[model samples]
Target: MKKWLLNILQCIQDIYQILKEIKALYNQFTIVTAHLQTIIRLIENYNHLAEEREKTVDTDQHQREIKLLDIGQVMKILNISESTYYRWVENGELQPRKKGKRHYYYLFDLQDQIAKCKLKGRL
Candidate 1:
């Protein structure tokens, strides 16, 4: 009876040690997986930013005669609303493009106009 009890205790101790080791291994695997995922996300974000930068540089190179500014940029630069901008266009005050309900302004022309207007206003 004493021998049987000793063997049973030994078996329980062995199982406990195995379970502890398995839990530790699982924790380590999870940590490694999380770290790898974070690295992949960082790499993907960097790649996207690099591609965007390259495209922007290419656009800058090819566009020499005219640089275009979309509506939001126009408003921010001129401090005006869409209605006023369109009216100016219609009255032939500021030349612009109206294509598919989107307006675009020529960058260099707009800058010249802003300078003249600021000079007149002493602003």
Candidate 2:
């Protein structure tokens, strides 16, 4: 009877250890899921911005002259966030013309970027 009780206790300890490991794995999975959700949101935002940009480009393509646009105007025209624009500029994917405290982007370059991103399946 004493030996049987000891064996049951040992089994219980093993089960407890297994449960702890499962809990740890579950926590890691939760963290990964959150990161995946964030990435998905970012992708959706980019696709929406690309769609908006395509519409604007289609309308503006007929014009021979490209316009220099400020941050606010570019954001509105591209339907992208200020942070994304800044990040793109920092990554050298986009360029800005700085004049004192003001920055401007050329519409033609933005359109070209949109086309490249689309070709890369980024949009």
Candidate 3:
């Protein structure tokens, strides 16, 4: 009877030790899971930032491809004489991008000018 009781106590002690080890492993697993979640969030944020940079690059490329117009095309679009166009240029109301001896204008710039003129009731 004494031997049987000792064997039972040893079995209980072994189970207790196993339970303690399992609890420690569970705590470590929780910490590892938290770290993994943080890493995933960082990766998602990096991907979002990369997507934004790509969009900015695409917009810059599009702007580079924007059409440039000459003086005659600008005069025809604005329906103004060459003298009036030159006067507006001298007045700083029209700014043209100059390359060597040629002056070029962006369509977007002309559209903005038209919008400003409309706002002032001049168009």
Candidate 4:
């Protein structure tokens, strides 16, 4: 009977060890699941921001195309003098269309030129 009791006690100890191991594994799984949820949230946020930026770019491009300006307005926007504007025009750096003796400039063209200059560190 003593021998049987010792065997039974050993069996219970084995079962206890297994239960502890299972609890540890469950804790690790919970931590990993939380980390995965955080990663998913970050990815979703990034995607949302990207979509917004794309929409803004499209809207900005459409607005620039629809807007038009004259030489004086262009000069004001560029913050340059009349002489400088004529100099650029003379140098063929800018081309304005003359409609019935009135020169007109496209806002989109000027914006593109400015963006290029900025990329080249000239503006």
Q: Candidates' lDDT values, in order?
A: 0.80, 0.83, 0.87, 0.84
Off by over 4 Å in 4: 69-123
Comparing 1 and 3 on TM-score, the stronger one: 3
Cα miss at 19, model 2 (Å)? 0.4
TM-score of each: 0.51, 0.50, 0.56, 0.53
Better of 2 and 3 by TM-score: 3
Which is the leading candidate under lDDT? 3
State the lDDT of candidate 4 residue by residue for 46-120, as single tens digits: 999999999989977786677578989988777678898899888888888788877788776687667756777
Q: Put down candidate 3 lDDT per residue, 37-81, tens digits, no spaces.
A: 999999999999999999978876776588889999988777678
Query: On residues 3-122, what C-alpha lDDT tens digit does candidate 1 reach at each position?
Result: 999999999999999999999999999999999999999999999999999997776566545667897887667777879777878888787777888878766557666786687773
Cα deviation at 106, candidate 1, in Å, is 7.5
Compared with the true structure, what per-residue lDDT tens digits does model 2 show for residues 1-123?
A: 799999999999999999999999999999999999999999999999999999887867744266678889877766668898889889997788889978887777577677766677655
Q: What is model 2's C-alpha RMSD?
A: 15.6
Return whichever of 1 and 4 wins on TM-score.
4
Q: TM-score: which candidate is best? A: 3
